[model samples]
Target chain A: MSFLLWLESTGFGTFVRESESLFAYPTFIVLHTFGLSIVVGISVVVGTRLMGLAPTIPLAPLNKLFPIMWFGFAINLFSGSGLAAAAASTTIPNPLFIAKIIFVLTAVAVMVVLQVKVFRDPEVDDKPLDTMSKALGGSLLALWLLAMISGRLITYIA
Target chain B: MNYSHIHIVLNHFPTIGTFFGLALFLYALWKKKQDMQIASFVTFMVMAVLVIPTFITGAAAEGAVSQRPGVNPALVALHQDAAIVAFTLLVLTGTFAWLALWQYRRFNAPSQWTVWTVMGLAIITMAMMMQTATLGGEISHPEIRAEGVAEVTAPPEGEEGIAYALQMWMVNNAWVWPTGETLHFTGMTLLFGVMFLVNFRLLGMLRGVPFSAIHRFLPLGILGFGVTMTSGVLMFNADFHRYVAVPTFFLKMFLVVVAGISVLYVTIFDDTWALGKGDGTALRHKIFAVTNTLLWLGAMYFGRMIPYLE
Candidate 1:
């Protein structure tokens, strides 16, 4: 509790919370939104393909998307940190916020599993996607939806 | 002149353009002229982009006209309802027309089923636009109203039927606004992702995939746009006063129109559609792609900044 309060009291945190400058709080929020759009948006697109929406799109080349998704994740990490630091005491203890974190983490894990078991397969383009990969894809989409819902709700419910 | 003047000037384009495009499309189909078909598709797409500004400015026009002593509020409401239906159908027709052109570029001919689908949607949309236009005329032009028609008594306060109830539900419920926001955010992500994939391909990434294959996913972007527009309308219906006065809101809307037109450009224009695996885009295509991407980003920025700017 003390650590969280201390984190919130830091100069950076104070600036994020109190500064009238658009660059301070709003920029972080905008970056967070852009990051969310990139990561979850790309994931959903790739995930839907794996779940059998557009089979003509070869799976192997989609491996190129992971780096972009990671770049988005990196943006989210920094922006999210700034946001959390600004209200550490309230956010850290909020169950909705905690759930959002877990949802995002689990979604990322599912993305990695798809990357390895699906995209990395040597015969991925030649063979039909296995049932396991399809299930993973479905789960990935569901997890991201939950993450988005929980993240949005935190603003209101918390 | 304000938005009302702008609305009147721009409003005739969608109805007239759709009728013109539909006639040309049918004539092309009869004559088997692919070039004419493409021209009609372009017409439909341009009308779609123009309709965004037309529909938005209608709200401003409503505010202006509804304040006049002789204007009937009930007539305005009825016209708005019809306009909503027409607006949605016109946009759908435009999308189908765009897909038809994209098909033509990819396969050397648009699919028979898609061609028929566009025709069906365009026909229905044309009818809706005519109905909306007539209702709008009746709002101020009593000369256009049917002779001896009964005066429309404004419904007692708080009794304007389903639209009023829905708006109240959105306002009265605690969860409604946040839920709309969540959906809006999700929709934005979906929209952004698809736009990124398509525009980046023009910007030279995703080279292994043919433009046609990525083109198949444009409907997903459209689906996202539909979700966002629906949720956005719900929010606006609930609290339009917050939006109407905000300069950032107007800027965001203007960017949406530009981004929308840019999407159509990449859809039908041969420069990007002809791109195959390992193909490099022209410099102009690259410039358009970058502009489209920035327009979307600007829209998102202005939309997010509305509260602060206000």
Candidate 2:
């Protein structure tokens, strides 16, 4: 509770909450929203391809999106921190917030697993995705979608 | 001249251009000439390209006419609303034309899906455009609203009463806004992800890969745009008054038009999709590519700032 209060009172937090400038809170929200889409949305597209949606799309070309996924993640990291800081007292103890964080972490883990086990392998590009690979893609997609929903619900439930 | 004059001059091109393209496309299909089909597809895209300027001038025409005597504001409003919907559909047809062109360039023929979808969308777009044009004519000419026909009364205000019922429902629902926010982001991801790849190809990063290969994902990008556009309309209708005087919204719309034209430029210009490339070789191509990138990025930024800025 004390830490929450301290965080809420910080300059960054106060600006995020109180600043009327377009560059502040609103920009953070926009960045966060676009970032969420790229990170999770790219994964969904890649996953869909793996699960046999638009098989004609080259699997190798999709690896180019990994850097973009990371870029989105970085944006989200900063914007998310700003968001949490702005309402630290409310957000810190909120069960939805906690669940959102957990989902985000798990989603990231699933993405990493898919990235390492499936996307990185050059041999898998020409061949059809094996059942296990398809399942991993499907799992990662579900995790990210759940994470997005949870994150969206945090403000309402909090 | 003024916007009204400009609007009058440009307005007929889209309608006429579409007919010309449709005629050729139909002829091509009847004759079973693949080359003519490709040519006709190009014509449809050219027609789409023409729509940008015409649609932009439409708002100006409305603004000009609103100030004049004997014009019914409600009728103008109806025309403006219909124009927005028609413009959206027409642009979608443009996107389909781009895919068709890309397919033709790469595979020696356009995809069957692209062919059928463009035909269907073109028909729909033509119907809507004709409706919008008629409404617009009613605003200025006043003859089309002759008392004998369907009532020429101004459309009633306040969500147009039940025409906007679904919009009202979404607005009233708490979950809708948040869901919209989440989906809006998802849409951005799909759009930007594919766009970034396309621009990089122009920048010469993805060598040896035909532009058509990346172009396959254009539909995905369009789908994303549709999601965001739908969400945006829902939110705007929820509280339209807040936006009437907002310069940012207008700026966003203007940039969207410019950004849209830039996309069409990238699509129709042969230099953009040429297979033998290591970065766009020509200075003009490079310029167009860079401009296209900046325009899209600018449009996105403006869209994001709509609620925040003006």
Candidate 3:
């Protein structure tokens, strides 16, 4: 708790919370949003393919998307940390903020399972995906969307 | 009642109608009833088409409620932005459903693949509808607001950036706002139509139509993108502060970057080039096509969301 308050009182935090300039805190928020869209958007598209929505589109090349997905994560990690730092005292205690974290973690776990267990499976190209992989793809989307919604709701309730 | 009131009254129909339509579609999917699916597609299609007015009236709603006491301009902006995004997805889902119906009517029945495609789109659209509804609920209902969420403070009265001549002129002129908005929608429609053709082709729909044939129409969509990009900037310059303060606008700009990158990618790396009937496209290229389509739609979603989420 002390740490959060200390961080919030820092010069950076004050700048974010109190800045009138468009380029300051708001730009960070925007970057986070884009990072999120890329991460979540690619996940949805890849997941959709896994579920056999686009059967003719072969699975071999999907390996290329992992890097793009990671790039989005990097953006989010940087911007999210900055955003969180700016409002630590208030944001840390916020239920929605907590919920967003939980959702994001679960999404990450699901994403890992998707990347390691499903995408890396040797039979991915030859056989239909197991029912579990399909279900995980759907869950990944749901969790990330929940996180985004909760994060957005923070502004509404606060 | 004015536009807002009419919107409030009519809004329930689309939201409720979606559930009713989805229920029917689900029933059809379960029973494998082609005819039933066709009927439900039409139902979904009608529901999607009806949302257009609600979306247009939304600006009017903003106009009406913006000045009312206890109304937060930021909340209204967020709700409006969220609504536009949901509406865009709804439009895409509806158009896809219409195609499904056409497939059935012309061919005597759609393939299993077509049914699956429709189901996938419906699931996505339903999710968007729920998101949109939730954001809309937050506007007047503070009780529903997430705990500890701060109300967005209004920025200063005036916001002016570098101010290009035409952009400044449009922003200053009241008449230009609506004109820009109308053009924005027209551009959106043109882009969506082209996307439908291009994306569906990538997904193996319109198989008889060659990739090169569809390639010919890329410029039309690019033109639409260009139009919207210009209009969007004008709109932004018009009310710089509201948009800048709104987080969603920044997100929209990011999506535009994604869309722009995808356009560059497609021009250079679209693996479908030189492909024809009986010629297969590379998997990587198809993935790029799909990604680009979603990126643009995502951009559109964020663009509309700017006002409400901002």
Name the best candidate (by TM-score): 1
* TM-score of candidate 2 on Cα atoms, chains taken together: 0.80
Q: Is 1 or 3 the stronger prediction by TM-score?
A: 1
Error of 3 at B94 (Å): 7.2
Model 1 lDDT tens row, B85-191: 78888888888877787777667788988888889999999999999899888888888896633277667877775456667999889999989998998888778
Error of 2 at B200 (Å): 3.1
lDDT of 2 at B103: 68
For each candidate, what TM-score against the reference?
A: 0.90, 0.80, 0.46
lDDT tens digits by residue: candidate 2, A49-124: 6787666556665666788788888899999999899999998788878877887887788777777777778876
Residue A36 accuracy (lDDT) in model 2: 72
- Each predicted complex: what DockQ? 0.71, 0.36, 0.02
Model 3 lDDT per residue over B48-105, tens place: 6567556655555676677877677776765665666667666666656665654454
- TM-score ranking of the models: 1, 2, 3
Pick by DockQ: which candidate is best?
1
Looking at model 2, the pairs that clash are none
